[model samples]
Target chain A: MVSKNQIKLISGLHQKKQRFANQLFFAEGVKVIQELLQSNFELEHLYTTLNDFQTVHASKRTVINEQELKKISALSTPNSCLAVFKIPAEKEIIHSGLILALDDIRDPGNLGTILRLCDWFGIEQIICSKETVDIYNPKVVQATMGSITRVNVSYVDLKLFLAQTKLPVFGTFMDGENIYQSKLPQDGIIIMGNEANGISEEIEKTVTSRLTIPRFGELQKTESLNVATATAIILSEFKRNS
Target chain B: MVSKNQIKLISGLHQKKQRFANQLFFAEGVKVIQELLQSNFELEHLYTTLNDFQTVHASKRTVINEQELKKISALSTPNSCLAVFKIPAEKEIIHSGLILALDDIRDPGNLGTILRLCDWFGIEQIICSKETVDIYNPKVVQATMGSITRVNVSYVDLKLFLAQTKLPVFGTFMDGENIYQSKLPQDGIIIMGNEANGISEEIEKTVTSRLTIPRFGELQKTESLNVATATAIILSEFKRNS
Candidate 1:
């Protein structure tokens, strides 16, 4: 049984400001909640319809009804469970081996998918511009499918970070060298741009290597690939021969 | 000025049953609407807040306020315009070139993103299992970002189609040959499976070539890639050498 105050607090966590203020974010479903439990994340509380998670201390979990679950769930169709975890302090950026840099990626879904891709490709670290969507956003946590536990993501001033990094910075462009023909390195930062815009102008200036994924479509009218998919292809190419 | 009846009709198109019964679907935003207008799609009507699409006959266009546009829109935030178009007859599936076979891809966004990827990679034809999500879903039309205009998508009995085809059939699997080291053909069908259930057992028997995208992550904990991103990587690998 959830109190009205508890419901209001969980709902407020849906917003970035509220999440930051409380240092709390919630993940839905058994899979994501389990992953967080196994990782370094600290459990603030758990609410579920089922009598699961026997390992969790009784004080940390509450057996709630479906109606109660729905009240706190961000998803239109509420999952069986939702668990709130404290947002750990940001870790130091691991500056080696195929770091992905994001230049103002605004979509929570895209950011989450990119984290999963980085986890898949063994790319450990992600550097996001301050303008990028907060990783603790519920949609992102859902989309990551528990990959949030595997990758290290840090939000920073992207232009300054790019300017100072010793590693070669790569970004895709239409006039750049074909990625298939280019010799990719094991250690570099691959920058993916915004949905509506490619990499920002100032960020583009800091890029040391410009690569292009050649369009095979007949008309070449299809302007761009989705950022998450683009990250998948770029990561695949960089790691294919490694 | 859209009448109450017109608003109801547009809202009904959100459902597959209503869309099929009416033989029409709607697209939101200026770019998507403009692409459909230029293509074979016959415009049923257009509603816009702006005085754009000057080429469209005045009889086919209506100037409406943002509130009215919201009433007809599927998005949380309505674009400047929405246009309904006659659902064109499905074209014959082209038997040649690299074909993308989707086995019950249920997400409208994934379907749309895959269509866009196919357009980018020059894969002109897509064969969808009858169980796959409708290509004309409003979310799909929006996510396609106008690539729906370039690619031809047809829904059919995917298993039977695979059994009868003379070309080699390919599908990704956990124990399959590593894609990077394998010899990929330019004229074959690549099957991407359902979001949660990979490929169905019956359809798995029809795949002549089994390939896998190797995982590079240290923990190998990422269970799978999103269907659209997987499609992007596979298509890139196949076309890179050509």
Candidate 2:
């Protein structure tokens, strides 16, 4: 049985500002919650429709009805459970391997999908511009499919970060060298741009290597690949050779 | 000015049943509408806030306000315009080059992204299981941006189609040959499975070539790649060598 105050708090975590203020964010479904439990994430509370998650202490777990679950759920169809976890301190950026840099990616789904791809390819860190969507956004957390626990994502002044990094910065552009023909390195930063716009002008200047995924379509008018998919191809190319 | 009946008819096109019943579907935003207008698609009507699309016959275009567009739009944030187009007859499947086969791809966005990828990679044809989401879904159309006009998508009984095809069929699996090392053919079918359930058991039998996109991450628990991104990577590999 969740109290009125608890419902308000959980719902508030849906927004970035509220999540930052409380230092907490929530994830739904058994899979995501279980992943968080197993990771370094500290659980604030757990609300479940089923009397499961027996390992959680009695005080931390609340058995709630579907009606109560619906009230606090960010999803249209509430899952069997939702678990709130305290947002851990932002870890230091691990700059050694392939690091993905985002220049103002606005969609939560794209951000989440990129994080999952990073997790898949063993890319440890993602550097996001301040203009990028917040990682704690409910849609992102849900879309990550629990990959949120593994990746280290940090939001910083992207231009400044790019300027100082010793690693070669790579970004895709139409006039750039064909990615297939280019020699990709194991340690470098691959920057993916916004959905509507490719990498911004200032960031483009900082790119030490510019690559292009050549279009095979006959028409040549299919504007661009979706940013996340572009990242997948780029990451695959970089890793396939290594 | 759109009449009451016109609004009702346009709104109904949002559903697959209504779209098929009326033999029409709608696309929003100038870029998508313009692409359709340029293609074989016959425009049923056009509603716009701006006095644009001057090439369209005056009789077929209506100047409407934001409120009226909201009433007819399927998006939460309506674009400046919406144009309904006749759902052109499905073209014959061109089985020659690399073809993408979707086994019950249920997400409209995934279908759209795959279509866009097909366009980008010059994969001319897509074969879908009957259970796959309709290509004309508004969300799918919107996500495709304009690639909808270029790619040929046909829904069929996938298992039968695979059984009869002369070309080699490829599908991703855990124990499959590593894609990077495999001798990928330019003329073959690459099957991407359903979002939750990879490939159904019956369809799995029809796949002649089993391929895997190896994971480089330390923790190999990352389940699978999102269908669209996987499509992107696989398409890249097929085209890169050619």
Candidate 3:
């Protein structure tokens, strides 16, 4: 049974402001919750529909009914469990190796998908502009599929980070060099731009090299690839050759 | 002003069964509506708060307020316009070129994203198993962002389609040859699988070539890429060298 206050608190974590205010964010489903439990994220509480997660202490775990689960669920179809974890402090940016930089990615799903992509490519560090969607957003945590535990994401002034970085900064542009032909290096920052806009003008200027994923369709009417998929292709190219 | 009957009719288009029953689907936003108007899709009716799309015949267009739009809209934030279009008869699948075959892509967004990727990569044809989500799903249509006009998608018995296809058949798997190292061809059916259970067992037998997008991340615990992003990478590899 969940208290009324607990329901309100869990639902509030759906918003970034509440999450920040409380220093807590919740993850749903057995898989995501289990990952959070195993990682460094400190669990504030756990609610389960089933008697699973027996390892969680009695004090921390609540056996909730589906009706109660629905009250706190961010999903349309509530998963079996929801676990709240304290948002750890943003870790120091690991500058080495291939780093992904985001210039104001607004979508929670895209941010989550990009994090998963970063995990797949073994690119550990991600630097997001201050305006990018919060990684702790419930939708993002859900979409990450526990990749949030794997990839280290930090939010900073992107322009400042790019300006100070010693490594070459790469951003995609319409008129840039073909990525397929370009000699992509292992040690550099790959900047993906906003959903509607490509890299921001300020961030674009900081880019030392510009790359283009050439569109092959005969009509060539597609304005751009979705940022997350574009990231996947770019990371694959960067890692394939390395 | 939208009549009660009209509102009811348009709202019904949100579901696959209703869409098929009425042989219609609706697209929201001026951009998507305009794209449908410009393409082969026949407009059933157009609703807008703005006096745009004036070229649409007076009888076919209705000026409705935001409240009216909210009633019929599938979007959380209703766009400036929503247009219902007749679902045209499925075009015959173009057998040649790089044909993308989906074994059982269940997600509407993933299907929509793959369609956009196909448009970007210039793959003209897509064949899906009957179990795949309907292309006319509002979420899929919204996510496609007008690329639905460019690509030809059809539903068929996927196993039979692969068995009879003269061109090479490719599917991604854990033990498959590395896609980066493999010589991808211009003419073949590259099959992407369902989100949870990838390329069904029966369909696997028909795949003549198995390819894997090698994971580079150190931990490598991420089980798989989202179907759409995987499609993006696979399509890029096939088109990159061609």
Candidate 4:
């Protein structure tokens, strides 16, 4: 049986401030819980309907009813399982892999999708600006669909990080050279920008090379590409051309 | 002053059947409404707050109270203006232009993002399998931002469409030719598959050339890429190589 206090505590994690103070986040759905269990991520608690007692160590599992599950779920329709995990605190800067730096990315879903993309591309560490959405946001946690366990996401002052890193910084710009034709270094930070805004002027100055995914239509009426979509194209070209 | 009947009418457009029966869909926020008004789409009604009216078109707009706006709004926080527009019934099929055919895409946001990509790339038509999510879904509409106003989306039997059309049919596959080196046709259908499953087996048979976006990281464990991100990269590459 799950206690009322336990439900309240798990529900509290839906809020960012509460999550940050507690250093924990909630991930719902049976699939997400199952994936997190096998992961190296530490599970503070797991609540499920199936008495998934056989799945984890005694200290980590909690058998709960459907009514109790609903109280802790962020999803509109409550799922059978929900798990809370402690956010990993140690994030090491990898000097030689394909690192991604997000500049003021606001959407939790976009951040989560990017996290999944980073995992798919084998990007080791995701460097984010202070203004970027927290990876632990319930929406983000859900959107990653289990990739949160594998990818390391850390918030850092992007300007300071870019200025100090002794590696090539590639930024996307309309006037920049075409990404298909441009030479890409094997190791560096590929900085993606805000949803509506391109890279900030200060960070733009630090980019060693500015590359663009050339528009197929070349129409002035159409606005620029979405930030996350652009990131996909850039990553594909970088990896494909390399 | 907007009547309760009009408010209810706008709210009803939220559902797919209602949108179809009434021949209308809702567009919210200042940016989306402005783009809709500027596009070829015909507006059925426009409701806005007084603050928004100061800069908006005079005389043709309906000035509504915030409470009334709340009644008609699909958003938790309503924006400055809301518009109900008649979906354009006639869309020119430019056979010579690059086309994007989505087969049973389930995610509204993914479809919306693809539509925006079409707008950015100047892709005039996006053919959808009937099983694909409605373009007017609130989540999809929100994700497209304002690009829905510019892109044409039509639902048809995608397999039949692929078979009937004389142009080349390119589908993404795990073992297909690397997208970077593939010789793409100037004008053809680029068929993207469903979320959980890629292109359907039926659609797969008709694919003239199967292509794959090769992943960069050697140890990547994920079976396939996100459909929307893959769409973005594929579209970019097809345009680049052309």
True contacts kept of 2: 0.84
Which tens-of-lDDT digit does each residue in A105-136 have in candidate 3? 99999999999999999999999999999999
Relative to the real complex, the DockQ score for model 4 comes to 0.66
Question: What pairs collide in candidate 4?
Answer: none
Candidate 3 Cα deviation (angstroms), residue B102? 0.8
Candidate 3 docks at the CAPRI level of: high
Residue A236 CA error for candidate 1 (Å)? 0.4
Against the hidden true structure, what lDDT does model 3 obtain?
0.92
In candidate 2, what are the lDDT values of residues A1-242, reduced to their tens digit?
Answer: 99999999998999899999999999999998999999999999999999999999999999999999999999999999999999999999998999999999999999999998999999999999999999999999988998998999999999999999999999999999999999999999999999998899999999999899999967888889999999999999999989
Which stretches in model 2 have alpha-carbon errors above 4 Å?
A: none
- Compared with the true structure, model 1 gives a TM-score of 0.99
Model 1 Cα interface RMS deviation (Å): 0.8
Taken over the whole model, the C-alpha lDDT of each candidate is 0.95, 0.94, 0.92, 0.82
Top candidate (lDDT) = 1
Look at candidate 2 and give me any clashing residue pairs: none
The deviation in Å at residue B120 for candidate 4 is 1.8
Q: Write the per-residue lDDT of candidate 1 for residues B1-242, one digit (tens) a residue.
A: 99999999999999999999999999999999988988899999999999888889999999999999989999999999999999999898999999999999999999999999999999999999999999999999999999999999999999899999999999999999999999998999999999999999999999999999999966999999999899999999999998
Model 1, residue A117: what's the lDDT?
A: 89
Error of 4 at A213 (Å): 2.0
Docking level of model 1: high
Quote the TM-score that chain A achieves in each candidate.
0.99, 0.99, 0.98, 0.93
Q: How far is candidate 2 from the true structure (C-alpha RMSD, Å)?
A: 0.8
TM-score of chain B of 4: 0.92
Estimate the TM-score of every prediction.
0.99, 0.99, 0.99, 0.94
Off by over 4 Å in 3: none
